[model samples]
Target: MDVEDDNSYETSTLQVLELKTGDSLRDAIGLLYEKNVFGAPIADVIDSATTSGNFLDPYIGFIDFATMVLWSLEIGELAKSFLWDPFFPVHLNDTLFHVLLLLSKHRIQFVPVIEQFSSKVIAFVTQNAVIQLLLQSSGLEWFDSIADKPLSEFRFENDEHAVHLYGDQSIAEAMHILWENRIGAVAVVRRETERLIGCVTRSDLHLLLDNDDIFNNRKSLTVEKFIHLEASKVHSDPTIEGDLGALLSAGILTLKNKFLPRMDSPVTNRRTDTLKQTMKNLAETNCSSSFIVDELQRLKGVVTLRDMIVQFAPPCMDSRINGGGFFDSALEQTGCHIEKGTLVSDH
Candidate 1:
């Protein structure tokens, strides 16, 4: 692959996924609502998607209702259909161009990848994955230049496995699965035939987090039941404009009704040594972040150089002008006196 040095490239070592970069998370959210991916208005999705009986912090938890949403308009309907095959799935062995084709067709960000023979879901080929793969493939000789170590010793690879949930499950039920597994996404399956309904992501939950109504509303509902109510219905009728209106009116809809790019393209990084090797992987693939998966193709977590900086370095050295207890200073600049950290709420 020819390495082009565009503005998106960082030090000839990394590339940022710029497709969605200039776009604001807020605007993307509004587009999702307008398009009806959540099956209701922003407020309704928030209300419908929240859990009722939980109190992580009482006051603090309530504010979770204001969390930012992350629904991508790029991944939509066909993405949802792929979600319905309990076993049939999009896989990772495909290519970047192929993945782009899937997204072009459906507008989904996360697509489930399955094993060929057993027809079992194994891994997810996220948009981020394709970009990272692109970046990783850019640096092929990093490992070959190193002595004796197998490339597999350091690089991350997809095991091609999946974590699943029933299509009839409630939002709260999905929440529990996500929380317990420390994962940000889940796959939904139907009740009778165990067909795939669709997949959900942390972005979806974040969108729901903005609604306060869900807390009081779901007190009596199970998560499985709640999600099932939203994801169970699938519409074969085609038309983004009309479908958007319906979903915006309700709380859930099928993935096929939305826009999702790329389905089952897998690209690989032939192993490399050192953190730079990782950076090379990211740059070649044009991904902002990449996952670290185990041999079983299950996700371990993600590793991004951005994350690396936040982890190892102190706040001041990172060139973040808003660093160095800046929020405290801004509050002080407002001339507010604090007797403790508590401010007197305005009556």
Candidate 2:
């Protein structure tokens, strides 16, 4: 597409959630959860002393939902903490290329769009939004053409390895692993076989919001017990008391309970699979990454959306090296394929 000339695409108004400096972190997190967003722009608190009195004039930073969770756990009170600072925001006049560069360089999910002087957040752009636009406009065939490449080429060995959790591991341990690795999810493997059973994610931890006691006692309880209790409570059709009874009957109340049932089926792909197929799976499932497996179903590597973006960047750079002629060629290719009867002409 003619990204530069088509300013219309870049200037479209986008409605986004904005967080104030003084807003409670818990309330902000709740708003994110309710809206199913990962983060929001953090606007500066209004300064009453200022003569302009423009509330949107200063944006300090952005707060990620995951960061909020970590802070909440640390302070023991979400209300005590304020939004984190030093966030990156994109300018309204910036081209899509600039946004792509920002997303790829920072490895962030979304970036806020702000006006030049006002610093007011007009909208936000997400990796998903950009990918969707590319797919709809250019189709996936080009991406699919590159899919036959092995995933190993894209794997980052210097980054932390995939951390797995045992069913009997404590929730505190799981949280620590997540925090240390700075990852949102981890594989839950069978203790004896080391085989993947299920997966646990930050969202799964949302179950803790339902019970203050459980949230408080997270350290003592095993993941197995927590999963069972959550499942029984959420899935059971009986009364709340009956659900508690079921939880007790399932032998999950005691710390000695060793039952470790799977929570959610793991999303995985073999290392032998083509990148094209993997990308297709990721798009269709709307997952951030897929576990790379070996012939024996052993966990080997991980292919994340960031990795894919990194891989695709070089080719895009190559296309742009010709001083914007690639878009003209693409447009020519598209025009040549138009049907005879569909052509419009001035009579």
Candidate 3:
């Protein structure tokens, strides 16, 4: 039941996307691309095709575009199937600050909000959603103290070296960098002036699935050409091969429309912009990350959704033992396979 009070939130019904074990790499990518979602849970396969669980426990693990792209770029042709990563999940009783810490530390998109009694996942609260809740606190003293501060006032560890590529660089090369660096997007700059010209994000890579023309001519296509294609496409010289798998596959859910989630135009910020202001821009643009640039439009640093969420957490020392960044290393240390993704626990 929903609380009618203006301050309370309700655990309402939701339609969550699910990836199956049988979904090929391309199939999963196309699903995410089609849905315009960053990540989703893999549906559990069992004797009966009915949904099962504590409250509604039918999912095994979760996966996202960033990890999927990384896998496609490196671990090709293993028939390697993937699924659930045991990530930090939240209970109804858990405090917001606790959830914020887990999100900031794990750098995850959504934290599973499970029922306290049956442990069924009732919600997958997203970073953007949480940020929206915080934005509601704009007038509060505690929130204002942090939001009013400029970007320079906050600490950005390892932010100076944002991954980037030149306009002349091939789209293939950009994909390789995204795979190698474990990043979602890269800045495209003019080689001569090093000015921010455009941005090539993980979302842009979906062109390979949506447009057979792009997959056919990926080699000769430059980053600049790729960005241009987003606006008005011109196919490259036809080649023998086309897209890897059937771009359109029957998934648990149907695809929406062919609309790109992220755009080539770089949503940016400056050193002087306050946290409150930057958050507004990010929300307005529906962008996960923003490039901080100088007066000359040269890239200075980048601010991400994770960067914003972490800012709200109470000040503390880095507690990670092995420089815990992404879950890749953690999985390796535990000998976990692609199917058995990693999950973090606050305990």
Clashes per prediction? Answer: 73, 1, 6
Q: Each model's TM-score, in the order given? A: 0.28, 0.66, 0.72
Best by TM-score: 3
Instruction: State, as a TM-score between 0 and 1, how close model 2 is to the true structure.
Output: 0.66
True-structure RMSD for candidate 2:
12.1
Per-residue lDDT over 171-214 for candidate 2, one digit per residue giving the tens place of the 0 to 100 score: 77777777678775677666886666566665555556657887
What lDDT tens digits, residue by residue, belong to model 3 across residues 248-304? 111111223132133456778898998888876665444567888999999888888
lDDT comparing candidate 2 with the true structure: 0.57
Count of backbone collisions within predicted model 3: 6
lDDT of each: 0.35, 0.57, 0.63
C-alpha lDDT of residue 136 in model 1: 36
lDDT of 1 by residue, 1-347 (tens): 21112111111121111112233445534544444342111111223356564322111000011122211222322221111111112444544334444433332433444345543333344443333333434335532233234334432222133355665555655666655564444555556754444455553453353455654454445444444333323432324422333222111222222222111111122333344454444433333334444444334334443432221111232232222122234345666433333442333
Better of 1 and 3 by lDDT: 3
